[model samples]
Structure formats: structure tokens, C-alpha cells
Target: MKKEILKIALLFLSITSSSTFAQETLDAFLKDQPIIDMHFHITKGYGDNEIYRHLNVDIDSAKLYWAIEDYKKNNVVLALGGGPLKYAKMYAGAERLFWSGLIFPCTKTVEQDKPCEKEFYSESELREIYQRGNFKSLGESMFNYYGIPPADKRLEPYWKIAMEYDIPIGIHADSGPPVERVNKEERPNYNPTYANPELLKPILKKYPKLKLYLMHYGGEYSDQSLNLMKEYPQIYCEISAVSMFLPKEVWEPNVKKLFSEGLGDRLMFASDYFGTVRKNIEIIYNLDWLSEEQKRDVFYNNAARFLELSDSEIREHRKKLN
Candidate 1:
């Protein structure tokens, strides 16, 4: 009878130990998970201060470098957009960063006096830029900032180029931070009217092959964004600034709905601001409603499928940490 009791105790201890070992903190899970950030921007010096100031946060070089180091330590790779590409070039050869060709419109204000022309790259200029083989994606394009609709005539050739190269395009669409948050003097051209997700429908119909993800998951347009994802197999959305900046009550439900509707595989994780990356990861990780598989899909699997990383490539990436 003592031997029987001893055996039962041993079995109970073993099960308890196994259960303890299996349960992990969100941070621990993220440490082991590979993350691909599809909507990252590299800001230089105080260039981003004005925007972040609205959030009452201060940024400096040291903080920025720390964020980059955190990404490297966490096995997070970035699909980098916005530039002065020199900032991204700083981390070149590390293979941690992929560059996106940026396109900005010349129109400086909401007024009609300014003609809409390509500011950063003309069509021909962008072709040369892509020919250099440095850019893996095209944009973080601010179609709303320039007041150009996605189906506008000016952007047709650019879309064709994206199709030709099979390059993914990231666009800044829908309302971002509240307009009152930004200092009007600093961002005089800020226009929320043009930032609607509905604007992209015609463009999606026109370029079915265009690999694109709407940045911010079409802010405040959860229903429309999900419909687009369902209608177009190619459309994907990243939870970036919208996830971090919006009130939790507002953002959490939208994300939950996406998951409940079976859009887990189509969602990607991102922190548009470097400082918020850790917090953003924690936010998603702490959600009790998401299963381990759903978390894995959001953290890495979705991005792997989106970027078309082969099995060997994913294995190699995982092998690096081990």
C-alpha cells in the first residue's frame, strides 16, 4: 500500500511539473517566436518628435538604437519604410532590415493651387530606384497626404511596376492619429478626409496581383477592412500605430472581431513607432481570448506566408537563435 501511494505521488508530481513547464509568460513566448514587422519606419534625430509629442513621449538617438537592439535580440526583422534610406542603411549587412521604396506627392497643401506631381520619385526615377535592387517593397505611400485616390491615373504605372516585380506595397490609408493631436503648424498638410479605406477598392479591382497591406488596418474601418480581406485574397492588414495609439476599448474589440471572424491568418503584427514595439507585443500577447496557434500566426506565421518565405528559409531563421 505504501508503494502504491508512492507511485501515485510520483505520477502527480510529474504531471504538475509538465504543466508548469508548458505554461509560459507572454514575454517568454515572444522570445522564442520570430516576428516580422511589416510596417516599420526609421526616423532620424528629432524628425519624429513632433508626432510623438502628441503622445507626450520624448525620443532620442539612444532610445532609437535601444529599440533596434531589442528587435535584434528578440529575433524581429523589419520591412522598413519611410526615409532617408541612410538610417536603414546603418543596419545593412545584418539582414535584419528590408528596404521599401518611398513615394511622396509634391502637393504641399490642401489647396488646389499646388499641382500634384511626384515629390520623392517620378515614375522614371522610381524605376531607376527599383533597378538598383535595394528595395524589396514600395511604400508606406501616403496617398491621403497627397490627396490622390488609390485608382488615380498618376499611380497606375507605379502599380504596374509593383506587379511586374511582384513586390509588396504598403500604403498609409485611413484616419491615423486624431488631427487635434498633431500641432497644425508642424503638419499643415494633415488631411483626414482622404484617409478612408473605401478609396482602395477600385485600385484593388484594377490590380489584382498587387501585393499590398493597408497600414494601420484601415483605422476606424474595421468592418470595411475585414470585407476587403475576405473579398481579396491578396489584401492583408497590419496592426501597427492603430493598435498602439488608439484607446484600448476601441482597438481591442476590433482586433477580437478579426480573430473571431477567422481572419487570424491574414493579420500581421507591427509597431509603427520603435518605442512602442515592446508594449505592442505585450498587448497582443496578454489577450486571453487568443489561442497559442492564433498568437503564433499573428507573431510570425502570417508574415512568413505573406512574404512567401520558403520552409527552408523559416527553418534557417529559427535555427539562428537555437
Candidate 2:
């Protein structure tokens, strides 16, 4: 929890330098409403206080226990904790709080160990595993990092499984994180083309019922993101790491463009980084252009619809509206 305390201290320091986040009324507003953070991670390894370290930017880092506390503190009803199977133990008993994802066609496969292989699952076999494990979604998948687009022939059964059992999916559509100034591993295989938002067109064509979302809004491809949503009603995009890296002046306008184009309803709010949830929340909650209702849509309603939160879950979470 030291990381979280340090982050709050840093953010308190940050608000002094920049006028980019929560006012007193905004804090009250956020506390009163429930949120569904569509792109949170259970991991706490953002390795920050860099690049913008002079300004004390702590947007990308937090502690694991601290993040859970933050989620409940912020009234985040259902977080799509977008990490792989290895991270599932983090939420062992807190199943109702977040839905963890399995990284499909897993990245970082060490060829010798074959650590990322998936065995065939018969219907009954898969059902038993699903009951035992909490992989509610197949996602934060590394198509961009490994340069495998959603339409690759290998993903045929993956899509079929999602359609068959109604598992929601989230994928890495961003061009991956910018290389760090130090200790950064160069992404030799990273391909920007795989991150393009338009690439999902064919995948959706085959399975229009698929519950999928572009996790990072396609890195710098926000325009294509806008068009994809315009063309296909099935597409939803969340702005996370990309926004945290940008100055609010440059970042907020991209958001305004979606609102201006009538696509704001499908844009979900996500703080992919940890401890920066309030920063990300305030980015949407205090938007001057959006009505109170519209801001709620970005914060909660849109993701709720996209993820198909059950009526009982909705009713339970809606209690925070009071």
C-alpha cells in the first residue's frame, strides 16, 4: 500500500501543478454514483514517476490491495480486470467485484516451455473449468503486441466459443505502450496495423453477436475508432493509457469529437493504470460539454449495456444513485 500512499501524495502534488481533476462538487458526485470501470487491471506494476516524473505523474502505478480498496471506495461495481490466468488468484474470493479475463492466443510464449498452450475443451469439460475458475471474459488479448489481428484463421474456434457460451471479450487494440526511456524492452514484433480499429470488421461480420470491445481505442487511431462505431453498432472503445499519456487539452478534444459525432454513448471510461482511477474518472465526470446524464453513460450505463450486466446486478449497483 506504500505505492498507493505515494501516488496520492503525488496526485495531491499534481493537482497543485495542473488544473485537470476533481473539484469538491465533482468528488461528491462521483461518490454518489456507481461506475463500471471497463479496463482496470488486478496487477500493480505500472513502473511510473517517469517521463513526466518532474511533474510527479503517478498515473500508471498502484498497489494491488490498494487498488481493490480504491475500487470499492469509488463504488466500482464490476471491473473488467483485464489480465491473464496467472493473475486470477488476486481476486480469489471477490468474484462479484470484478470479472477477470484470460489472455487468448497468449503472448509472451516461451517456445521451449510451451507455457501458453490451450488444450481442447469439450462442452462438459469446459463447463467444469469455468465453474471452478473465474475467467469471465477472454481478453486484454495481445493481438497488437504479437501482431495477430482478430480475423486470423486460428481464432475461428475462439469466436465460436465466445458466441456459444456468451463470454464477453476485450482485446488490445492499442499500438502497445510507448517504449520507456530506460529498462524498456524494444517491441521488435509490435505491429501497428494489427492495432487498427478497422481490422475487427471481418470478425464482427462473422459473429455480430460477439461481446467484444477495443480496449485502448487503437492507440492514435481515434478517427478510425469513431468511424468503426459509426459503421458497426457492435463496437465499443475505451480510452485508457493513451489518454493518461496525453495532455488533457489534446486528449479531451478527441473525446469531444465522439460526442459531437453522436458516438459518445459507446465510449466507455477506463483507467487502465492503477491508483489513477480518480484522475480518469474526473476526466469524464467533470466534462463541461456533457450533461449529467451523458457523463453517467460514459461512466456506467454504456458499459453496463455493452457487457450485458444482468437486471439484478443493475438494480443492485443502481443503489448508489441515491
Candidate 3:
């Protein structure tokens, strides 16, 4: 009878300890941290987009409001958007944190194999469609599947246009299979070779002032991304889907090297959260290898400097925090 009583006490202690630890973890996460999700997407269709479709079956005014509230409840800054270019101005209003938007080069046509449907726009069209008031930067552009070689002359027009406007371009440089399967035997397009830094070397070298963002931890070309970061001080890398997709075992050590090798300030934390924001935030916060200060940069500081916002602006945002 004494042994049974002792066992019950031990179980109670264990449960109490576990509960306390979980609360501690959650508390640490919620403390005074400002999260600016630099890569988020909100489109009208639900489950129709491939990955996110499985997460939500509906997308309407009510659903969007719910989604916005959920993100806001979690202290998310912006939904760095992606979708039809025509709606760029409309979603520009959705940004409550900072002004950022995505321009999917391949979204203009259903034919993914051809060159981008509209490679270069007239000055008037670009201003009308993309340049809505203060939408500061143009995005995480998915270049890998656009079916154009990185070295093609066609990219020059894009370079000139974005450069002319002094806007930074966030490139989706990773390779991957089509999120949509068009053929039974075909594999997804998962190679970042088209964006290998060697191909970009000339363009980058030529247009030294063009602000290029290498997203996805350089995708399949991490080494190349590192080299670009080394060679061009202007180059930056946003850690998004890769951080969330990589398990802790693989990520802890690799991220150390990525930081040690001059990629520290260049690294920005992004959830790539269309569907995975909650999990990504947990994983990033739980990374035992990173110190709290390191996590702070990944969460906020790095992006503030990269985007060149003033100290006053950052402090103003901090003051408005809950």
C-alpha cells in the first residue's frame, strides 16, 4: 500500500514538471518579441493552390478575416503576399507591418515551360500595377520554374526596370517539383541550378547596384549563395521554408556554419508561412543552439536594417506592441 501511494505521488510530480516546462516554453515564446513574417501569402481560393488547399477548404471575406485575426493574435506583422499581379494594389492595403509584395514572374500564363509571359512592362504599366504608393520592395520572385536560363538576355530588361526604380528583388532561387503534378511520371522541379551564382555572376557584377535577395537558404545552391554573399555585400538571404522543413538534427549545426561564414546579418527569419507559420515559429524559438539575441536578429533586427528603416521607425513599431 505504501509503494502504491509513492508511485501515485511520483506520477503527480512528473505531470506537474511536464506542465510547468510546457508553460515555460510558451511563455518564453510570447515574451516581448516582434515577428515580421517577410514571406506570407493570401489568395482567394482555398485548397486550390496545392499545399495550403489541404489546410483550408474555403477562402472568402469571413475566412480571410479569421485568418488575419489569427495572425494578428500571434503578433504577426505582415502577410508578405503572393498571387495575381493584378491584385497587387488591393493586397498592399493588407500590410499592417511593413510594405512588401511578391511578383511571381511565372503567374502571367498557364504555360510554365515558356519564358515569363510578360518579361518587361512599359513604365506606365509597372507604375500602375506594382508601384502602389509605398509598397517598398518587390519580392521573393520564383525564378527557377520560369523556364528561362539565368544568363538569358531577357533578364536584363527585368534588371534594368527594377534597378531603375531602386527596388530590391527577393528571388526564389531554389529548385523544386511543381507543387502541382502535371504528369504521372514527371518529378517536381526541385533544382536551383537555373539560379546558380555562376550564371548570376555576370549580371550581378554588371548591375552591382541591383539588390538581389537569395531566398530559401540559397535553396539547392547554398554554397553559391554563400559565395555571392561573400563577393557582393549587397546580397542577402532569407531563411524561410528551409528552416521549417529541416529537422532540428540537421539544422542546428548547418546554421552555425552559415552564420560563422559572414552570413549573420544577411540572414532574416521568415516563416514562409502560408500554412506553416505556427510550427515554424515554434521550431525557431526552440532551437537550442541559438542564443536569445541571435533569435532576436532572425526575428526582427536583421530585416529592419536590411530594409533600411530608420531607428525611429523601428522604435515606433516597438512602442505600439501589446
Top lDDT: which candidate number? 2
**Tens digit of lDDT per residue, candidate 1, span 221-247?**
777788878887877888777777677
Worst 10 residues of 3 by lDDT: 182-191
**Candidate models: Cα lDDT each:** 0.67, 0.68, 0.62
Clashes of 1: 1
True lDDT of residue 310, candidate 2: 84
Provide the RMSD of all predictions against the true structure, rounded to 1 decimal: 9.4, 8.3, 5.0
lDDT order of candidates, top first: 2, 1, 3
Q: Model 1: which residue pairs collide?
A: 174-195
What does candidate 3's lDDT look like per residue over 1-322, in tens digits?
9999999999999999997897687667666777666675544544345533444444434445555666666666644554444344445665455455435454434432123346445556566555555565676565555555656664555666667777777777555434454332222342345756567787876788887777776346677778878888878777677666666555455566678885777777676655566666776677667788887787778777766768787776576565
Q: Evaluate residue 210 in candidate 3 and report its C-alpha lDDT on the 0 to 100 scale.
A: 85
- Taking the tens digit of each residue's C-alpha lDDT, what string does model 2 give over 58-84? 432234445667778877877886554
Candidate achieving higher lDDT, 1 or 2: 2
**Candidate 3 displacement at residue 112 in angstroms:** 12
Ranking by TM-score: 3, 1, 2
- Cα-lDDT of candidate 3: 0.62
Question: What's each prediction's TM-score?
Answer: 0.77, 0.76, 0.78
The candidate scoring highest on TM-score is 3
lDDT minimum window of 10 residues, candidate 2:
110-119
